[model samples]
Structure formats: structure tokens, C-alpha cells
Target chain A: MNKNLYIKELKRNRKNFFVWLSIVFGFTLLVLSIFPYMSGMGEGLTALMEQIPPEIGKAMGMDEQTWSSALGFYSTYYGVYIVVLISIYTASTGAGIISKEERDRTSEFLLTRPVSRKTVFWTKIAALFSLTLIFFGLQTVLAGIGLSLVNEGTMDWGIFTRMHASGFILICFFTAIGVLISMFFTPKKNFMGMVVGLTFGTYFLNAIAKSTEATKWIGYISPFNYMEITIDPHHAFNYWGAIVLILVAIILLIVALKSYEKRDMAG
Target chain B: MLAIETINLSKLYGENRGIRNVNLKVERGEVFGFIGPNGAGKSTTIRTLLGLIHPSGGRATILGHDIVSEGVELRKKIGYLPSEVHYYDEMNSRELLEYSIGFYDNINPDEIEHLADFFELDLAKNIADLSFGNKKKCAIIQAVLHRPELLILDEPTSGLDPLMQNRFFDLLEEKHKEGTTIFFSSHILSEIQRMCDRAAVIRDGEISAIENIQDLLKKQMKKVRIVFNPDAINRNLPIGSQNEKWHDQKVNFEYVGPIESLIQWMNESKVVDVVMEEPDLETIFMNYYKR
Candidate 1:
């Protein structure tokens, strides 16, 4: 990968990075802060859960049985917000990374340089992956702080690691898919629409699948199901889901690189 | 060795033709002009040579490297300015120029500063705030700052005022004096007339003619008008008179024959007045299109 281009990509992405970082941090803090108060009123919380239908609870990825624990509450409620926000971040970055040059009419300048298409493709991929790591790492740190502020000495570090690990891996999968989509379509505005569509489309599909037994097989097609936090087992990491995520990510990345190399660039 | 060569180069976006059977050769240090109207394939040919778009057929080479197989190496010795200029809006002119210079080792900072001064461009201003002409100045600076062996410019003066256009030509002349080969592509005929040593005229995705600028002007057809007294000679016109019109005592046509033959015809006819003038490139261009 070309260092100059990689650095240029980093500079271009820095502002958006901070904006996403603040959003995830603020959202996580607000949800985690309410956990302590909800745990204190156990009967009221239980009564509220009882009033809500089981199908709705499952659709929300909330655990009715483990709603009392700090990590359980976070994995149930705070988890969805984190995943959704990061997915938007990853998908948007992946969509914009290479196509933005064309959209901005700068491809004529960049592609005419001495750098090979392969180097350019891989450098953009590297930049996207690096941005994902930063987003994930910063969110983890802020989540840790928020959990400490409300856990009252009962927070489980092991469960936190496993949950975030699965989330990070799952984000990688979605990011690769985003890059794959970008290779086919161009200009920033159109790519963003596709990013939003695919991210939420799969999300709602996964929810729909969880709402009924007849549709559970549909969840297999959605990346959201691969990293879900299961309740009965107590926030255990899904190894097979992690495996599929890694494999799919690798395959999509390969397709992206090949397609980018063969495709024509417009100024 | 030739600075640039393309053999039967062609590009097609599926059924839409970009360029067809284009062959060009430019010797070292020669200034070559490519003239065509909008969508006439000037940019397409240049893009193929730079590997920005792969040729659908045929092949090309620049500075002795195959355009595809050795595109990276070829690009190191070449500079290009596209038809329209766009830059990273977040950067100031200085930052963008610095980023461009980073790609090439051994670029002279003093030369870059001199270019910026020649254009009267404020390097500290952000690109987003710059006018179209100022952005064009920045594009020109980046393209030539490397002192590349070959420079390809497509419609380089579209946004520049006449003064800036003259200054740009002077800059290109200086580069030419230093033995850099230039391929200038434009729809405007005057710029090509002022700058090019040889020119290739393309129409409908194919090269219609390639000739030295001076020769092209001299050999092109001349418009002829004749006014008769009361009686007009109805005798058959000369073999080379094209699209003749007859009305009252006036006759107009285009003549492409020896001057002596025209003089003989004028002497025989009851001609009160005879006017002959060479047509400009625009007229010639239109005539080519008409064919």
C-alpha cells in the first residue's frame, strides 16, 4: 500500500471519525446510566417486562431472564445501539473510500500518479479497516467507563470482552460487504443511500426472523444474527458465527479487490 | 525514440464508441496538438494512453513503456491536466501542491514557487474558496511541477482568461525548450494554431487529418466569390469549384485548384470583381464535418 495515499485517506476521514465516536459514546453513556435505577426497582422492572410480549423482547434482542445483571442489561439494550451506529459508520466509510475520488472528480489526478491500482485498492481497504478499529476501540473504552460508573462491583469483564469481540468481528464482515457494494456503484450520494438501505434492511429482516419460528431461517442470511448476545447462556460469544463472519469478510474483500482492478475509473 | 505512440488504439463503452482506430506518434521534444469538438474522442485517447481507461483494442506506449503492462513506470515520466479541474476542497493550494510534490522525488521548490507567482495565485487560500480560474492555475502547477518527460493537457485553458492563457502558453513553451514533449488537446482551434508544431484533427471518433500547422493552413480550400457585369458566363465551371451558386450577376463557390487555372477562368469570364480568401480552421473543421 502507498503510504502517502494511506495518510491522505486518514486525513480525509478524521472529522467523520470524531463525529461517529461522540455519537456512540453519548448513546452508550445515556443507556448505561439508567441501568442502576432500573435494577433497584426490581418488582417494577419485572412487571414492565411481563407486560411486554416475549416476541417483542426477542425482536429487541433483550433477555427477559437476565435483565437484572449490569452486563445483561447492557448486552440487551445498549448492545443494539452500539452495533447499529458502528454498522452505519463502517458501511458509510466503505462506500465512500474509493468512490469519493470519482465523485469529487479527483480520480484523474490520483489515478494518473505512479501508484498501481492494486496499491490504491489495498490502501483504501487498509484505511477503512484502521478506522473501524479506532471506532471499536474508542467505543469499548467509553463502554468500560460507563459500566464501571453503574456496575456496583458486579460487572463481568469476561462477558464484556466476549461481547465486544463478537461485535468487532461482525463489523468487519459488514464493512467488507460495504466495500464490495462500493466497487460496483460510485459517486458518494448514491453509495450512501445503498449503505443505509443494506444496513437497515438486514437489521429489520433479522428482527422479523426472530419474531416467529417459521421465519428463523431468514436470519441465517443476515449478518446481524451472527453476533447476537444470547440470554439463556449468559452473554456467551458465538464461535461459529465469528467463523462465518471472518470467512464472508475475506471472500467479499477478495471480490472487491479484483473488481476494482478490472473496473474503469471516471474523472 | 518516440515520446508517445498509439497503434490503432480504440475504446468502447459497450456499444458506445469512445475512440476508434486512433494512431499517433510524437517524436521527442515535439509539441503535438489534438483538435476535436466536444465528445470527439480527444480525452478518451489521452485517458487510454495514461491507463486511466483501458483500451478496448490495440495498444499504446509512452516513453518506451507499454501503457498497460508498465503503466506505473510510464506514469512516473508523464504529467496530465484533465479537461476540468477538481481538487480536494479541504486543502489550501499550498497543501495540495505539497501533497502532489510528495509523489515525485527531487522536485525543485523554487521552480514551484516561481510557477505560483507567474499565475499570481495565492497559495494560502483554501480550494473551496478559490474561483474556477484559480483552481485551474493550481491544476497547471501540479501537472508541470514534476518536470515530466511528457505532458498531456486536455482543454487546459477552458476557465482561464486570455491573459492567463498567454502565460500558460509561455510556460508550456519553456517546458518545450527544455525538451519535454507535449500533447495538447482542445476544441478551440486558435490555441492549437498558436502552439502546435503538428496537429491531428479528429471527428466522429476517427482521425480525419494530420498535418503540420503551417502546411494545413496553406493547403486548405479557399472561398471564392465572383461578381459579373450584365452577362454571366454560363460555361461549365472548373473541375475543382465546389457547391457553386448562381444568382443574377454573382457566383460563389469554394476553389481548391492551381491559382493559374483560376486566373485563366477569371480572364475568360465577364467578371467585374473576383475575391479569394483562405478559410479559417473553423470553416475547414465544418467542411470536414459536412463530409
Candidate 2:
């Protein structure tokens, strides 16, 4: 395969990349606008916490917050957002990257160029990777905007950096997962569903396993449980399960590549 | 040298049916046309050459390389316009053209512009807004802009109005004059007859016959009709074995071996009126399909 073709695809998909980024950033802005502050939120949250049933508060991660802080905000909102956003973007972009040509009937024109099929596939993957970066970067800006709306005072850049760092890892995790799902599914409408489902499905399993020591191993199954981001190093989120996630992502990408080679494109 | 050659190429789609035992050889720089009905496997054969669909049996070679195996390499030299022309709808023509630039090496942007101008295409219009014929022109511009060695067009003029259709053929003829090899498929008998130096007729997935225009006309049996007076005696009548009433008069009909026999029959039958029908490619193609 040619490397130039891959780069070319990345350049060509600029419009789609921007569209995806806009959707992600727009949602981030919505989330930021809705929740304005943690400083005053703690008292109100505490009052509500008193009335809430124990299980519901625990599920919301509210019971885990000792006091309202940026780190605590990460637990209740930003952290969860991290996993969902990554999962959604990765799965959508991954499945779409390769299958769009087939769905659009553009593969004949695209593949007929000097590029190889493998090159085209990888190029689409690279374009998605770039799109993921732009998406998260926009969200991170939206993250700052989100915070400023909630609190007028300047925030510690350290928290922002840490959160964004976890975001970077999450994006990769999504990409890898997306690639895996894209490889296995056919170019039908259900392909995107399968990819999207995998992300949510794994996250659900892990969330359920987090509460039970007996089924605790199930937490490791979901890629979402691994994305950890916080202010402090010891208590800060690290998403160290990234290693396992990355491994799985690689294996899935390989499966997708092999599947593309073996399967005939649908007429 | 043959630029493309297919030997016993067949494709089966379960019980639905597909092309079978198809053979063709298109020499370099020749404008070869594959003519067939709607479901007669014209597009199927083209798809096989492009490696979009795999052949169940036999093999096709392009520039001396197997299409399935060397498809990646061969694609660079071939430009194709699909029958149902569709493009990325979101981008305007300029943006789409800009995007395709990355896929190819060293294509002159100005040349594309010139072609667009020649074809009177509006580059700023989004594909969704363009009419079907305009969209087809876009597909054609893309296929030819790169100036590929071999252009494979599938019913490239199916949707064009007659004026545009004539213009398209003229453009194709110009492409041929440039020494570019063309292998196009079409269902329009007139267009194929006008454009191709040599054409193949495909029916029911098999090629019933391949012949040049002269030979085709020569091989067809003439239809000679003779109107005889109702009062004419029966002994001097021609060898025509059937009779039909036309304009309240008796007419003898026969598709005889030679023009001389038709003439003899007409001369002896006290013929009041006579007419002879000559065969063209359309009739020959239909007869070939019937067989």
C-alpha cells in the first residue's frame, strides 16, 4: 500500500472531520452550560444527598464526593463524559471510516486511484484519528468554557491538563475499539449499531462489576472503566487499564483488516 | 496487443442468474463496445474487469496482468464511469475535485477546469443540486481528467438527452483519436452502431455472436414482399409459399436465400407492388438474442 494515498484520504475527509468535531463540541458546550458551579453545588447537593436513597446516590457517584471540588466534578460529570464521548466517537468514526465508501458506492472511484485498498482503509483510519484529536481538543476548550460558566474565578491549569490527558488516552481507546468493531461488521446499517453497542455494552458490564467484589473481574471487561482523570496523583484518575484496552484495540484492528481482505463488497 | 482479454468469464448469483462463458479481447487503442439488454451482463462484465465482483470461473487479463490479483496496480491506468452515476453529495464540485487530487499524482487542476468549461459544468454547485446529466458529466470529468490509458465507461450516455448524447459520442470519438483505449458498455443500439469500430452482443450471459458491420449485413437474409394481382394465374407465380391480404390485395411473402430469387419471384408474379427490407444491427442483435 502507498503511504501517500493514506495522507490523501486524511486531507480529503476534512469536511467530515469538522462535522463530527462540531457535534462533539456542541454537546460539550451544552453540558458545560447546564452545570455552572461546584462551589455552591456542594451544599445543595448535600441537602439533596440527605433525601436521596443510598443506591441512587452511589450510582450517580455523588456518595463518593467528600466535598465539591474539581476532582469531584470529574467523578460526577467529566469522567463519565470522557468514557461516553470516546466510545461514541471511536465507534462511529471507526465503522464509518471504511464502510462509508461501500455505503456511498464511492469505493470504485476511490479504489481505482493509485491507492491500494489497505492503503485506503488505513487512510480512513488516520483521518478518523485526526478527527478524534480535533474533537477532543474542541471539547477541552469547551471544557474550559464549561468551567468558566460555572465559576468566574480562574481555574488551576493543572486540573485542566490532567483531565485533557485522560481525554487523550480515552480517544485512543475509542479509536482502537472503533477499529475493532469496524473490522467485524458488514457495511449494512447495523454495522454502526454494533460498534456503538460494543462501547456502551462494555461500559455497562464494567459499571455493574465495580459494585460487586464477586463479579469484580467484569469491570476489566469494559474499556470505559479504565479512563481515570483527577487533580491529585495518588487519588487522581489514571485509566491504567489502558494497556489491556490498547492490546484489545490492536487485536480488533487486525480482525477488521483481515475481514476486509476476505469479504466481498456488497453490490 | 490486447489491452484487455476475458476467457470463459462467468459469474453466478445463486439462482438469480448472471453472465456465463463470456469471451472478449479488446486491442490497444481500439474503441470496443459491449452491447446488451438491461440485464444482459454488460455491467457485470465491466465490474469483473474492475475487480468489484469476482468471476466464478475463467480469468480476465488487463495489460497482461490478472485483474483479480493485479487489480491494485491496473486501476491506476484505468478510468471508469459507472452506469448509475453518484458522487459525494455534501461537497461542491470544486471541493470534491480538490479532495480527489490527493488520490492521484500530478493531475493538472487547470485541465479539469478546462474540461468542465467545455462540458459547461458549474464547479461551485453542490452535487445534490446538479441535475442527473450534470452529475454524469462530473463522473465523466473525474474519469477522464486524470487522462488514464484505458477508459472503461458503463452506459455512459444512458441518461443524456439526444443533443447531449451526440455531444458525448463526439467527445468519445475525440478521445479515441488521441490513441486512448476505450471499452464501454451500452444498451442503446444506435449509439453503439455509431461509435464502435467493433462491438460484442451479450444476451442471457453468453455472447451469441461477434461480427463487423459489413459481415453482419451480408449474413442477414433479406425480407422481400411481393403484391400479386388477385386475378393472376397460379402456374407462373413465384416460389413464395405464404399469402397475406394487404390493401385488399394478395401479397406473397418469403425470406429467400438471395436477392436474385426475390427479384425472380417479383418479376413472374405480375407484381403490382414490391418492397424489400434490409437488415441492420438492431435486427441482428435481436435475432442473436432470440437464438
Candidate 3:
């Protein structure tokens, strides 16, 4: 869709966008710096796990762990927080992409230009993608930098990259959902609020249902559960399930685009 | 081919109707005015023509392209200013114009610069920092600098002061002289009277009348004056009745149709003076709703 047009729109509204990215990356940097300290707690927690029921360990994906390394810290502790943060941040970004124009009443002016609605939609999506990647990459780099200076270079880059990969996947997945919501729903603020509520509620339901063997599959229903947080890439990153979710989410996004193409803008 | 034509167009939002059964033809270079009061659906008709809203029942064409089916192509030749301008808050005037011009393939940067200078709009000021009128001027420049063939303005001077509003009208006149079909919606009859050669008054999602400004004035209407003489009243004049009494003089009113009945009623030797005023757009506008 027009890259120049997308860049122009972002450049026109760069202040808020800059603020949004700064918050995302600043929070990411803060969280990354503290995660190592939190890993010390993970070590203590793993020791405590030894005294708990084995069922608890099996259920939280903490059945096996080195406890002190980044991988273990990520597996048993950081995954939940990371997924939650990614979902919220990405959804906010996506919702802002379309709904912000409506909120500001600028969509009528913007869409009246010579571009097609599909082009405008894709341009916004591209701008959001670029913004998301820039912050995600910066946070990842700062995490690496923080690790080098503070951790005596003992940090696990593989675990770090894998975690980011999962985070990125989750972000894109939610972005697609956000686009769908933008396309289908009226420019009502409550829709974003509802989506945020559902994201957290789904995770809670999945975690609560995992105790039963028949209900274990409910965890797979949430994108958060599909990212695999067991400290073993082979066991944790459920490749087949993630691919399935991604494909399904992508298909849903296509439907959203089609709906946008057919529906009249709320002019 | 005409610049814009709506073929029996109509739109309805559920049971709440917008402009219904609207049929309009604008030639290649004519300023067609759309006049209506509040909730008159003037904006609705403009939005449907701009492809911002779909025609629930009929169709509109812009420069030979169907607005609904060929919107992208049709929009390329159209410039529009919404009733309430909404712009990117962070963009200064120049940044907004540059960003807007980047979308069109045939834009000339120098023309935009000239328009900005002509409108006395500072390009370096951010839109949010500018006053609402200045922001509207920015929107107008962005809409017109590309020199679109059809200009559909919805309340184009909603925020501007009279001086700037006149300047905008001058700009519109220049565009019209250059063969741009000018179409705009307004509730202010005085402004519409000034800007348009032919205006259609819409009332309650319907076009009440389409007529030339001069034609509306020619229709015989009430003309009244207070005279100092009560006994000089011409009883033979079969027209207006006495309005009120001023001191001892009875205010005589009568039909002045064809300007002859009043002339025949007045005796040049007896009348002290004469004061004649024509019908204004306000009276014509009220008469529109009364029908």
C-alpha cells in the first residue's frame, strides 16, 4: 500500500506515536533489567517447588528447571508476564491504528483523499507493524546490553531470542485481532476495553482448566498457552499448535479486510 | 460529460432517512449551492457524493466515474472540505499539505506553496497550535491545491471570520473560473446567495426547490411601509391589509404585483416620500419551509 503515504501519516502524528513507543520500550528496558534480579527469586522458587506437590510443578510447566538461568526464569516466571504485556501492548497499538483516526475524527478527512480504503487500512497496518518492530527490537537490544554489562555476559541469548520470537508471534496475532475489531466494530471505546478483558480472562480460564486431562487442551485455546513456556524449546514452543493458531488468526484477519471492503465507513 | 451527476440518488440509515430521492446535475464549471436549515441532510448528500457514505438506494457519478463502484478513480478528481475539519494534530500546515500532496500523483509543490502564501497560512505552525479557522484554511488548501475537477465543500466557511470567508470565496471563484465544478452545502442563506448561481434547498431529507437566486426574488411578495397620512389610504388596491397604527397614521399595505398596482395606487402629488425594499433570502427561505 503506499509506503510514502504511510510514512507521511506517521510523521504527521509522530508525537503521540513517539510517546507510545517510548513507553513500550522504556517499560521493556525496565522489566529486562529487573528480570535477572527476578531470576534470583526464581532460584529460590524452584527450591520451594521441591517442597510442593509434583502436580503443581507439572501444571505450571515448572516440572523441570535449572531455576537460575534465563531459560528457567523465562519458562516458569517471565512467560506469563511477557505474554500479558505483549497482548496488552500489541492490542493497544492495533486498536490505536484504526480507532485513533475515528477518535480524532480525522478518518473522514484522511479517507477522502485519493487512496482506496483498502490502501488506507493496509497503510495503517504497516505503520503499526513498523512501530511495533522498532520498539520490540530496541527492547531486545537493551535487554542484551543490560545482560552484557550486569550479568557478566552469562545471559542466555538463545532463551532471550526464543522468548522474543514467541512475544513477536503473540503481538502479531493480537494485531490481526485488533484489525478485525477495528474493521467490524463501530468506533466505540468499549470494544477495546472488552478485548483487553477477554485477553486476560482467556489466560485465567486456560490456567484454571489445565488440571484435568480432558481440560488440558483448553490451554491450547489461548495464544498465550501456545507459545510454550517449559524451558525446553522442543516442548515449550508448541510448533504445530502455534502454526495452527497463526493460520486461523490470519484467516480471521482476511475476513476482517473483506468486511471492511464491503461495509460503508461510518461517515 | 458533466463534472457531477446523481441519478435519482437516495440514502437511508435504518428508518432515519438522509437525503432521499436527490437528483442533481452539475455542469463542468458551475457553482451549485446546496441550501438547507439544520438537520436538512445537506451534509448527507455531500457525503454520499464524496463516497464517504454509500447510497442506500441510488447512484452518484463524479467526472464519469460511479462514486460507489469507481470511488478511487472518482475521488482523484474531487476536493472536499468536511463541515467540521479534522486534521492530524501534530502536523503543522506545511507538513499536513506535504503529507496530503504526497498521495496524489499529479500534484505540483509550487502550487501548494502559493496557495499557503495566498491564504496567509503559516506552513510551519502545527495544526493543533493553530486556531480553528486557520486549521480550516489548512484543510481548504489541502483539498484544493491538487486542483481537483470537482470540489464538494460542506460548510466551507464554518469557522472563518468574514474577511477570511470572503477570501475563501475569492479562492472558490478562481477555481470556478478555471473550470472546476463547485458544489457546497450551507445553512446560511446569505452566504449561499452570495456563492451560488443556482441553489437547491433541502428540507427534511428532501429537495424543496431548485431555482435561480434572481427568480426567487422576482416572485411577488409582501412590501409594506408606514406613512404619515391616514386619510390618503387607497381603498381600491385589492391587496395587503393594514399592519398597525403609528400615531394618527394608519400603515397601508397593498399588493404591488408587477410594480404597477402600487404605482397606480400612489398619487405623486399627495405622497410625501417613497421607500422600497426587495425580498431578502431569509423571507424566501421561510417560504420554502412553509410550503
TM for every model, in the order presented, reads: 0.88, 0.83, 0.86
lDDT of 1 at A175: 89
Higher-scoring candidate on lDDT, 2 or 3? 3
Separately for all candidates shown, the number of backbone clashes (residues 3 or more apart, or on different chains) is 0, 4, 2
The regions of model 1 sitting more than 4 angstroms off are A186-189, A208-212, A228-235, B14-16, B220-279, B283-286
**Evaluation by lDDT, superior candidate among 1 and 3:** 1
Interface RMSD list for the candidates? 1.1, 2.4, 1.7
Ranking by TM-score: 1, 3, 2
Local distance difference test, candidate 3: 0.73
Provide DockQ values for all models, in the order shown: 0.57, 0.46, 0.59
Provide the TM-score of chain A alone for each candidate, in the order shown. Answer: 0.93, 0.79, 0.79
**Model 1 — interface RMS deviation?**
1.1
Question: Lowest lDDT 10-mer window, candidate 3 chain B?
Answer: B237-246
> So what's the TM-score on candidate 2?
0.83
